[model samples]
Target: MAKQSIAEIRKKEILSTFYEVAKVEGLENTSFAKIAQKLEIQPSLIVHYFKNRDELILALIQYNLDQYKQIFSIAHADDLSHQEHLNKVLDKLFSLDWNELYDDGVYYSCYTLIFRHPEIKGKFKDLHLELRSGLKTILEQCTKAGFLAIEDPATVAHQVYNLLDGTYYFVSMLDVKADQEKYLQQSKTLAKKLIGLH
Candidate 1:
């Protein structure tokens, strides 16, 4: 059990190193040797946990999804209404200051790799679907409480997701010195309006 625990810890350490290096150097630049160097271990150490580069990439994808799941955990599922739950998710996504270690740019990078690279498409697809369903659940809850129109909550959730994705893309690329708080406020306003929250 001790050996297994150590292995698990090493795996997590390797993943962390991969995330930091990938964020700075991009996914294409992430190599086993680079991660090994960062962790001060043999490249084969990574191979021991991840069979290949593709496997490592898949693990990173899972890590990204886990981060979002954690965000949802803090969200108020029992808020006064479905709209309130939707509001909490949006606030967590845009307003809450996430750590630089796992900032919006990190998510953008992971998402970009998932879409642009076909090698790991199959692995990422299920995770993406799960994320969509999670978002839709929040919307459905809002509709149940009359906070949103009784139209298709899943479709509306997808639209809200697109808005969040677009904002993250803009934040990742643009060098504008505008306040994130203000931008987040505008995002909430638009989200409410789109959901017909009034």
Candidate 2:
């Protein structure tokens, strides 16, 4: 295989370093210098990869969303009925068995950053809309398969997507065991009812 390009290697190193720093020190406290220190590289190296902190954050947001698409795509892929597939997706999302080590923290961090930084907030919102669009397509297919109600798939998809986003927001904020399970189960019930699967 040909050697990886310098740009590819630097991008990979930067993202990996960013995640490590964000995971340890809350994302709110992460900085380019911290990531540079983590990688034992000069801060200028990080700056070279990302023009500024805002650009770095945008890259991180894309990375986070791509990860979600990867997981959700595989988890929900099957030739089952719409309701059956929806049920499986919900179970995969709301299961408490692995809540302690869930990957939702990265998203929470990204959202929190956007909430604080209004200038880049639009980009974050765009990414969210993109996610909702994907979900809408899947839900529309389910409706055609007689899995969901005969309503606007886009509208219904937004409802389901918002509920999930809100639920995970709360989940990432609380103590993993405190009321996470209770809230997630309640979310599952509500999502089922909203999607008319119950």
Candidate 3:
């Protein structure tokens, strides 16, 4: 595999640090100096790459969205059966750690911040719908293969996405007994019931 250039590596490091910091300190408190401190470098290094916090965050959003696409592609580009495919999708949807397909902290933070930033909202909306459409495609394929019972893949796709989002955002905070496997099983059971799977 071709190695990433020095510039590319630095950019990744900076973005990772930004996510870690924002996830901990709230995106409101994330600053170039804080990122620099986290990386043990001068703030100028970050400023040299990004003129301001908005620039850095915009770049991070772009970087993260691309990573999201890669994850989605890998998960769907497999030969899993209908049951196995639903499991794979939900495992990713609910932030399961075994596969580690998505970064929940960064993903949630971007979603939370979008409320105040319309431009970011637009970008994230596109990414969100793209993933939902991917799920719709999976459901349609699974149904064609006689693995599912959903007649309205479009509505089911949105509903499943909402379930995943709500469970992660709210249930994760309110439910003390939560674990990845439990959520995985719950998701499986729910999908099965939704589509009348035996």
Best by lDDT: 2
Question: What would the TM-scores of all predictions be?
Answer: 0.80, 0.81, 0.76
lDDT for residue 86 in candidate 1, whole number 0-100: 65
Candidate 2: which pairs clash?
none
Report how far residue 148 has shifted in candidate 3, in Å.
2.8
Candidate 3 Cα outliers beyond 4 Å, as residue runs? 1-3, 63-79, 91-109, 178-184
The whole-model C-alpha lDDT of candidate 2 against the native structure comes to: 0.74
Instruction: State the local distance difference test value for candidate 3.
Output: 0.73
Relative to the unseen true structure, what is the C-alpha lDDT of residue 183 in candidate 2, on a scale of 0 to 100? 90
Off by over 4 Å in 1: 1-4, 75-83, 96-119, 177-180
Give Cα distance to truth, residue 157, candidate 3, Å: 1.0
- Give, for candidate 1, the lowest lDDT window spanning 10 residues: 96-105
lDDT by residue (tens digit), candidate 1, 74-181: 534654455566666677766535323265655555566657678667656776677778878877776776666658877877777687766655565545546555
What ordering of candidates by TM-score runs from best to worst? 2, 1, 3
Q: Using lDDT as the measure, name the better of candidate 1 and candidate 2.
A: 2
lDDT of 3 by residue, 1-198 (tens): 998999888988998899889878877788888999999999999887788887787777887667765545445446667778765666566554423444566667777868888878887888778878888888898889888878899888888777766656654454345565576567657765665666
